[model samples]
Target: MSSTQKPVSSEDALGQKYDRCLADLLVKSGVGFGAGVVASVILFRRKTWPIALSTGFGAGAAYADCDRSFNPARIPGTRILPKAEAPASK
Candidate 1:
């Protein structure tokens, strides 16, 4: 590494992390759009592209934002801990 090269800071890394999140949002939104279209056609028995597109985009975007904000680590764990067992009587 050259002395002139600067070390990557957390701020710099955050941008790339957000970029990945945005990509994920876009891809998931696309999938949701398709799903919504199919659902509309199946349930409504007609072309409801507008509703489908809006619903899909809204749901996907909301989900992505919420997921990112609330569960950045994506760890599988419960907020509440298990209660300890009581002592057995003789």
Candidate 2:
């Protein structure tokens, strides 16, 4: 006989998906910051404040884009889970 397991609830699925997206955003932001700092240093060495400022703005824009794209629903309390309210055993 064939058997099929029930799929996860929508809430649980969405929570997992959002967690992954948040992690990806954080990693990307770190990379973006590092790239921005390197570019800014190069511009500074060239004695160009305008270029450095523009690079910084670009980095900010990238971060903003990630924030808005991944955080559309604004999941509340997704970042922290209290220890007292732990799930009980059946």
- Per-prediction TM-score to the true structure, in the order listed: 0.49, 0.44
lDDT of 2 by residue, 1-90 (tens): 889989999898878777866676566656665665676677556445545465556556655655655575544445544688767769
Show the lowest summed lDDT stretch of 10 residues, model 2. 72-81
Query: Candidate 2: lDDT over CA atoms?
Result: 0.63
How good is model 1 by TM-score? 0.49
Per-residue lDDT of 5-88 in model 1, one digit per residue for the tens? 778998877787777777767777777777777777777676678556856686677566757555656545635334666555
Cα-based RMSD of the predictions, in order?
Answer: 9.5, 10.4
Q: After superposition, how far is residue 72 of candidate 1 from its true place, in Å?
A: 4.7
Give stretches of model 1 more than 4 Å off. 1-7, 47-90
Angstrom error of the Cα, residue 58, model 2: value is: 8.6
Which is the leading candidate under TM-score?
1
Per-residue lDDT value at 60 in model 1: 71
lDDT of each: 0.68, 0.63
lDDT of 2 at 21: 63
